[model samples]
Each structure stands twice: as structure tokens, then as C-alpha cells.
Target: MLRSFTKYLFAPALALAATATTLVVAAAPADAAVVSVRVKGSLAARTGAANWFGKTRTIKNKQKVTVTCRVSGQYLRGNVRKTAQWDRTLIGDYISHAYVSGNPKLPVCAPPAPAPVAAVPMGPTGTMTNEQFLAAAIGPAQQSQRDTKVPASVTLAQAILESGWGRSSLSANDNNFFGMKCFNNAPGSYAAGCKSYSTQECTAQGACTTTVATFRTYRGSVDSFRDHGANLKSLSRYAAAFNYTNNPNQFIAEVHKGGYATDPQYTTKVVNLMAKYNLYQYDLKV
Candidate 1:
């Protein structure tokens, strides 16, 4: 009976000790000056103090964001998420403190304003002909189709949709036709680093918001194609999606389930692009 009681108390006692240690360290002096912390890399600011929380937004590399408070949270130290200290921002989101360095101590913040919902844009953009875009991307798509089990149609379609028919600046300059991220487990051959570009995203509820962010930049579009394949193959979350070969709809739907892209109509758009372009025929040949 005594052993059972001691075992039950052990966990709570450890938790309390951890919390007390954190609270003591974070308690600011009365004259402490508040300051901003520069992000060492792109950081996801979560809705709460846990990695499981929704990423409320992102902070850019080397950008200084004002820290309002500190709390203990879970952060990925390499592949493992561990209990560690976190810093809250003026936006009321929590970022793992490990992502920031070279900053002064901070003060507890006032209750922050609720994060505002972002707007969505509905309908068409640009006047680039589909043939023009298809012509540019088909070469890499065919090669990718052969190499990865991903259909050329799906690859081409995702490129067309994400890159605005190769008109988006990330495609034009960075050769990042697919908007892949540097933070992902991309093969080193393709994962050079990140590039900042203004882009749009949609919530699951279909509300769209425009924001600028850094993504994996590449020497050419082929790298983007290859990395897209790598992402599907290497990431465990995408394994189920990668297995549905030759079926574009099932393949895209599975990737979508793994949260490949944010546009509410992503799979629909890819399917439409494939249909409109006879892109599936290449899959048969390649």
C-alpha cells in the first residue's frame, strides 16, 4: 500500500519540481527590461505550450520578435519532442525558446490580443496559358515520375497549381517550382536552404490568408521535383500516401491527408490540371 502511494506521488512531485524550477528562473526582477529575441531559424509559433497545438503562425529567421512571457513547452530537439522552456510573443503564441538566442531577459506580458483570422481570396489569378506552364515543367515531371513512383501528372499538376503556372517569383528565380520547405526532411541534394516569398494559404475551413515565408530554394526546378518525391517517400506521415501508385486521385488525396498543401481545393485543382492537360499519358510512358 505504501509503495503504491509513493509511486503515484512520484510523477506529480517531479512535475511540480520541474514547474517550480521553471517559474523561479522565469520570475523577472522588478526592474528587468523586456526585449526581443532573434530567431536562429524559421520557427513555428503554436497556439499553446505544446507541439500538438496548432501552429498559429511562423516567425522568420533572424527576425526579432518581442517576447512577452515564458512557459515550459514541448519542442523537437532533433527528432524527439522534449519538455523545455518556451517564449511567448506579443501575438500570444508560444515558440520553443531553443529556437531563439542572444536576447535579454523578458517580463510577463499583459493578456495579448486574440490573433485575428486571415482572409481568403476566391477565384482566378494571372493569365499565363496552361500549355506554356506545362511545356516548362513536363521534362522534370517525367523524370520524377520515373524515379519516384509519383505520377508525372500529379507532379506537373502540383507544380502548376503551387507555382501559378511557373509565374510565381519562387519558381521564376529560385527554381522552387513546388514551394517545398527547407525545414522538411528533403534529400540534401535538393534541400539547399529557405527562400522568403509572399504567398497565400487557406484554413481547413477555407479562409485564405496571405503571408510571406521562406521555403526551400533550389538551383533549378528539377531539384524541386526531386525533393517533392523525397518528401513523400522519406516522411513517415506521407508513407501511406506514397504507396498509392499510378492512381493520381488516390495519391494526391493521401498526400493531402498528410497536409502536403493548404489550399482547400488542392487535390481538386491537381485533378483538374491533370485532366485538362492529358498529363496521365506521360505516367503511362514514363
Candidate 2:
């Protein structure tokens, strides 16, 4: 009776071992099939992980390459925050021309924009009417006197100067309004006399240098304006700039002091423009 009991227990144990071995072999093929491709570019502020830009490398059954986005800037770094994933073919839909064409296979993806942040309410400020796209060059400001920070305004002004009313080759062709660099991701160029921030000196140094940083050209001016604002809103370091978020002019002044614009008259120019054209009114409804 004791020998019979021992045989029954041994049979179950052997069967369990065989089952485990079979499962391991079946899963082995998947490990070899998985391959990952890392594509660097800004998709949002919160995205920094290796796999955020594209789909997972462990493709389902028979999928091809997986793409990921890594978007960074001098003051801003990491993958774009809150990006929506897309197939590899649609990847170029979000990236600038210069970056998208670099790899035809890489898909472009865009981050979901946050809910519209209200500035102040303005009642029909009237239509824009300036030659040379002057209003376009000058950005919007807070609608009231209570807002704080200047980084966004200051950065906008600088971008205006750098891109020459959004007409620069980088801006017009690539939608790169900031002149940010492609870092090590691609071979990029610059206009003569353009300055680039050094990796050691810049705050976000994922291959970003001050010298003619890469920029993304957009479908329209609205896209550029929106992206510029989103970029500022994403970072914590620019909190001081956002604190004055209610006051567009104050925000411009704050940004100048924040070291956004190097020009000594940066504040004066932005303030003058704001008051002259009532650009601050845009903030009211924004």
C-alpha cells in the first residue's frame, strides 16, 4: 500500500515539470522577435521614458518596427507630455519636415493638448490690422492686470526676432520657430551669426546646443503660437513666468528678468508693442 501511494504522487510531479518546460519553449520565439527603435524628438513635456513616443517593441504576432518620440529643448527636456500613439506611417503627421524626412519609416505622433487655459475674457477686441504681420510677430498677453511671469512673452518676442515674423527658412519650411537643434538626432544647419546654447550651459541637454537649435514648422501661425504656449506651460522651471500668467505685459517683463531675452530693451519693446496694439486683449479670451 505504501509503494502504490508513492507512485501516484510521482506521476503528478512529473506531469507538472513537463508542462512547465513546454510553456518556456513556446514563449522563447517571442523574445527573439522583439526589436525596439528609439526616435528622439519632443512630443510633450511629461514624456521622458524610452517607450513613450511609439508603440511597444514587443509587436503583436507579426508587427514591424516600433517608434518612440523624445522631445527636448534648452529649458525644456524629455518626451512630450500626454502624446497619443499612432501607427508608424502616421508618425510624420506631427513632426517638422526636417525631422520627419530624416527617417521615412518613423511615424510622427502628437501629444494631446491640454484643456484651453483661460486668460481673461475680452469682448470683441476687433480684427487684426497691421502690415508685415506685426500683430502676428507680437504675441498675446493676459487680459487683466493681475497675471504674473514674463518667460512666455519674452520667449515669444525672441522667437519673433529670431524667425523674423515667422518667415525664416527654419520657421517657414520646418515649422521650427525656436531654431532649436536636432541635437545628435539629425544633421542640422543654421543661419549665419545664429547662437547655440552649449550642452553644459543649457538646462535641457539631450544633445541640444544653443547654436541654431532645430525648430518645427507648422501648418499655420495658430499651430506655432499654440505650441509655443504649450511648451512654456509644460515646464516647472517657468513657473515664475506663468505666475504672471494673468498679466501679459508683466509676464513679458518677468521673462526678460528671467533671462529669456538677452536684449537690454527687450522688456521695453514687448511692452510698447503690447500697449500700442492692445495685444494684451488676446489674453482676455485665451
Candidate 3:
């Protein structure tokens, strides 16, 4: 489920201490400034900037909470105001700025540094070589097989075909290697969120159309791989594929027959890739 940005109204403020005990801020830079703000109403403080994250505590009305920095997050409308700003507290919890009464200015939290990119062996055309892509994918594919009883070869082949060897923008930018669409943004699911993209989809009759759609987003490629296996395992339509876990070709054909993709040749394409690349060697014995 998408995080609920709905703010709940509570009873009027009670007669309590104006301030609570000080809390040491976490994840703030040493020189970062701290500010205190009274809670306008009872509200939850979350572990992350987004409401989807776990709730840390419920801060009652009129309580003074010390905040270290601020960052843009889920838009919230509360008693004090409406805003996308979230205040990071001394206790490292995130509270919606819309619930805080004080107008104290806070420093913008520094954006997390980008993850270091690993240098991969590039082909003559300056793209990741097919061999290099397979090398990187083998571990995740086999792990998925171990976890879901899906053939590692089928997983690797799907990754290769769907992601274009990690060249597609979705795979490169969002780590969504399987082009997995978001049917439901359920909390604690493999999907962290959804991202919109333009894609070409085909009908059973081979009629194709370009359309904009929302696809599932993952924290990393490993999550994408895991989700792919779990998705196949969970769906009743794809259950027959599990019967052929030791046969990558038969497994992928069953997946295609179950309408995993609209393309009529989806199974052939995946199987061709597997055969050409000797992907069956990666399949785990079920």
C-alpha cells in the first residue's frame, strides 16, 4: 500500500510539561543545527522520511521535540500546516513538519552520496559485455532458484532479455530488471515504490502499442531478481512452471503459456537466449 499521508486529528492538547527530555540526534552532521518545535497534535514519528517506514513512536500534543534537520518527503497536511517537509528528530525519527507548531528554520539534510559504480569489462561498442552481465547475474539467479525453486537459467535468461543486458533505463536506473509492473504497492512487499515509464506492449495477436505504465521499483538488482522469483512462485498462473524447475526451457515455456508476457514469441526469445548463452548450466537441481 502506498504510505498514507492522511493526518489524524486528535483530542485537544492536555496540560503537560512544555518540553520533553533532550534526545541525541543521529545521522546529522556534527555542524548541523538543531531546533525544537512543539507538536501541534498527536502524531506518529516514523523511522524513515516516508510514512511507509515503521513507526518509531507517537508524540503527543504540546510535546517539544528536538529536530536536527529537514528533508522533503511524503506530502502531509496536519493541524499546523501542510507540507512535504519532514523533520529529522534528535532521536533519529522523522516527523511531518505539518504537525509541528514552531517555525524554526532547519538545515536541509545532506543528500546521500551516490553508490560507487563498479567498473565492468565493456564490449567493443562500449557496453557491458554479455559475458560480464552473465557473470554478475549468476549469483542472484542461483540464489533465486534456491529461494523459489525457479530455474536459475530461466531467471538469468529473463534478465538478459527483459533488461537488454542491463542497458534498459529501467534496469540501469531503477534496478527493475524484469519490467515488473506494479499491480499493488503493498507495504513490506518487494516493491519499495512505483515509477512511471513509457513501454511497448504487445497483444496476443501480435498487435503492439506504446503506452505509459507504472512499474515496480527495487532498492537494488538483487531485490529485483528475488522479487521475480517470488512473483512466479506466488502466482497461480505460473505454478506449472515450478513443476519443471530442473528444466529451464520447459519452465520458461510454461511461464510464457501462463501469460507472463503478451508477446507470442516471449518464450522462444527467452529460450533462444538461454540456449545461445548456455544459460542452462546455471540451473540448480530441484
| Model 2 residue 11 lDDT score | 59
lDDT per residue, candidate 3, 41-89, as tens digits?
4667898987789998988766777787889998865455667998898
Q: Each model's TM-score?
A: 0.51, 0.36, 0.55
Error of 1 at 174 (Å): 0.6
How do the residues 1-286 of candidate 2 rate in per-residue lDDT, one tens digit apiece?
Answer: 9999866744554453231110000112332322243333222211222233442222222222233433321221112212222223223212211212122232223565899986522211112333444544444322112122333344445455556555666665554455444434442322212333332223322243344343343444444444455545554655576677667677766655665545567678767755665554444433
**2 versus 3: better TM-score goes to:** 3
- Residues forming the 10-long window of minimal summed lDDT in candidate 3: 13-22
Leading candidate by lDDT: 3
Clashes of 1: 2
Off by over 4 Å in 3: 1-127, 185-188
Cα error, residue 162 of model 2, in Å, equals: 3.9
The candidate maximizing TM-score is: 3
Candidate 1 TM-score over all chains jointly: 0.51
TM-score of 2: 0.36
Residues 1-286, candidate 1, lDDT per residue (tens digit)? 9999766745554453331111112333545544456554466778987778998876666666766667766743421123476777777788765434333365554564889864321112233576766765666776677777788788878888888887787777777777786555443567666767787888999999999766887765667878887777778877887667868888999899888888888889889888987888878444
